[model samples]
Target: MSTTERPRILVVGGGYVGLYAARRILKKMRYGEATVTVVDPRSYMTYQPFLPEAAAGSISPRHVVVPLRRVLPKAEVLTGRVTTINQDRKVATIAPLVGEAYELPFDYLVIAMGAVSRTFPIPGLAENGIGMKGVEEAIGLRNHVLEQLDKADSTTDEDVRRKALTFVFVGGGFAGAETIGEVEDMARDAAKYYNNVKREDMRFLLVDVADKILPEVGPKLGAYGKEHLEGRGVEVYLKTGMDSCVDGHVVLNNGLEVDSNTIVWTAGVKPNPALSRFGLPLGPRGHVDTGTTLQVQGTDYIWAAGDNAQVPDLVGRKNGNENAWCPPNAQHALRQAKILGDNVVSGMRGFPQKEYSHANKGAVAGLGLHKGVAMIVMGKMKIKLKGRLAWYMHRAYHGMAMPTFNRKIRVFADWTLAMFLKREVVSLGAMENPREEFYEAAKPAPAPAAPAGAGDKPKAKAS
Candidate 1:
């Protein structure tokens, strides 16, 4: 905690940016020159691309996350939430998991907190709708889907069964598309074990405000994706808005009403709201305004990247427009963090910092097992693929891109093992409420038998 020691670089959020940024800084900086400290609420950085498979039980949840502490051994990893930043003082207020809030002073700061799911004033969204933002959500969705099956199979009541069998997804982007696909695949596999619940009996709906889905992949691939989903009996409602999900009754803008117990919301993500609390420049969408060099425009010591930073896309140049910013995705986040990290070292060493420039590498999305759509961009050539080949390409790219070597091998192994074994469909729903059984048992029950008395035996026999 001495002010005369090595300069401190404090990184907030341990997602794609924070993890790699610290790693790059640790690699570039000379010993005893600076110290890198990463702060995040969770110790691990989840490979979000595998979340759908995790939800589908295609991969183990434990393997999907890379522990930050284990990877960045040279950097100090603090598990905490950063409450406020006093840019003038170059200090961050951190609320650690175990102790009272304290201020952490630093010479440089990197804001990489990432984005949160964008929800609106929908009546029951906060209370009922499920989000697909983290590993917990993926696991919750899996358990909730399987629990629906349990309800449908056990209950004789037609209304309850109908309510439980219907599943609704609010967005048709990659997250929504892959999630519904995986869950539907899981439900289909699960039906084989159930006596009453048939796959045909269940209804899956994907609703979006846009006329087309997966715009990142060109129109042709998006249309193909829609057709593939529809062929599997999933309904696509486009150019329509969701009015309310109040009382679990989904009222659509087009006058369609459905009573579904499971509603997954992946509409979109907005920049973390905490960025606004800081006295910094923000773009139209509330993202921290950053220059092409990935540094806060007016500041020298502070840098930002990932979903929270509005970084201009220099690679996708147009007719004299050089300020087009990069989109918030794993592809850009990964590249941006590397540059951002290098730029920090460059600043410290008085070397020239380079601007971020990367062209759009199109998009790929897996509809389900052995089914997907991919659009890869190269110079003037655009490659479009679908079906099993596209699925393999999707897996191959993401699997190789999985953050750490430890995770990359495990994910590849999961895919390898999947070739021989059927996907898991069992629901560990009790995980959601892990203490429910303990609380039930702890409830003040009838006084314990008085030394296993004769009176207790007589009462038990009479009952």
Candidate 2:
């Protein structure tokens, strides 16, 4: 096909929305009708919900990600980031991992560049706090937590042992609560193998500035989750903020001070600030403004979804809410992706686009092993569950929601094996710096002081 005849669809970001939307659009388009190109910093899209399980060794870290190239074999997958978008010229400047940036012209664009961890100016947060945004962070947290356990067990100093054993998590949202719970469970199980360490010797503290936790599951379930976490010996501090966490020394606004080796920051996320440079209209919170149809406001060829777009909430609007927008979560992202894909195809064909609308079904959260909380919405009734039943529901929902069938089967297999076997409590901290020993071994030996006399003779021979 001639370049002039072929239409190009450039997708910026190979994340949840970008991957699914591109796949849908490719499946619907006829051969040689349009070219689909996906650009992202990473080559794979991470399944974030399973991160906690991965951290706890319930699932493999590699299994929680889908390779964009393998999944979108028919489309061109570019491992780069679109640094700038010139809507007027219909061109984008892609900055690849290597080499220089280049301009890529496109007939249409999809901005699915997802959000980043929202952090504050808290002291030492940048240096000490570990985030839970990706699979790497989850794996790192697991190894770090286990290494801390080893340190505590081997140390004779009471203060050092206490600091190593103390785990502080800041954030009560799904990421914060679930991660702390999973890691704490792993730490407890790991302690069983250590003679010097016990579960009771470790201190797990969860702090949130909000008055309650898991607000998505409603008040009753949120309260239950807080109670359940507290019952597990986790110090739950609500309506309290951290003033400083410099050098692992955490000082809370509630007059509580502790020295902890592990500090996890999962407080919240902000939309990708790169959108500001894209020349698109962004919301007050720095998200792309979109209508119910998931189309960028005041634009015909550009569309957006996922955590980056502030799409209107049809369910809330129907309920007489004036200011209602969809929350940044996996539930809306998955659904909005399908709708956005359909709308893009229809717009390309000069057909009317469908409005993106859906009421939230419910929410589920696993609190490690056989403990959890779930709220299911059936018709107008709300069904709440806890304990083992809730945990199963959480697994079932996420297992099916996990991208492709291959991933679903793999995740299910991980769970199936876990049922018959015990969780792996071993820490492969060396995985992070696997080349350390190799680098040491590979170092060149110093020249045997080319005997000062040997160097002088070599210089005379050269002369």
lDDT of 2 by residue, 1-463 (tens): 1144588999999989999999999988888888899999999999999999999999999999999999998898899889999999999998999999999899988999999999999999999999998999999999999999999989999999999999999999999888988988899889998999999999999999999998878889889999998998999999999999999999999999999999999999999989999999999999999988889999999999999999999999999997999988889989998998888889899999899888888999999999999999997999999889999999999998999999999999998998899888788999999999999999997766554566454445565
Q: Show where candidate 2 strays beyond 4 Å.
A: 1-5, 446-463
Report the C-alpha lDDT of model 1 over 1-463, residue by residue, as the tens digit: 2344778999999999999999999999998789888999999998887898999999899889999989998888889989899988888998999979999888988999999999999988888899988999999999999999999999999999999999999998899899889889989999999999999999999999999988878889999999989999999999988889987899999999999999999999999998877778899999988888998989988899999999987765553576677888889988998999999999888898889988888788998999999998898799999999999889988987888888988988988998999888789999989999999989888776566456553545565
RMSD in angstroms between candidate 1 and the native structure over all alpha carbons: 4.8
lDDT minimum window of 10 residues, candidate 1: 452-461
- The clash count of every prediction, one per candidate, is 3, 0
lDDT of 1: 0.90
Name the 10 consecutive residues with the lowest summed lDDT in model 2: 451-460
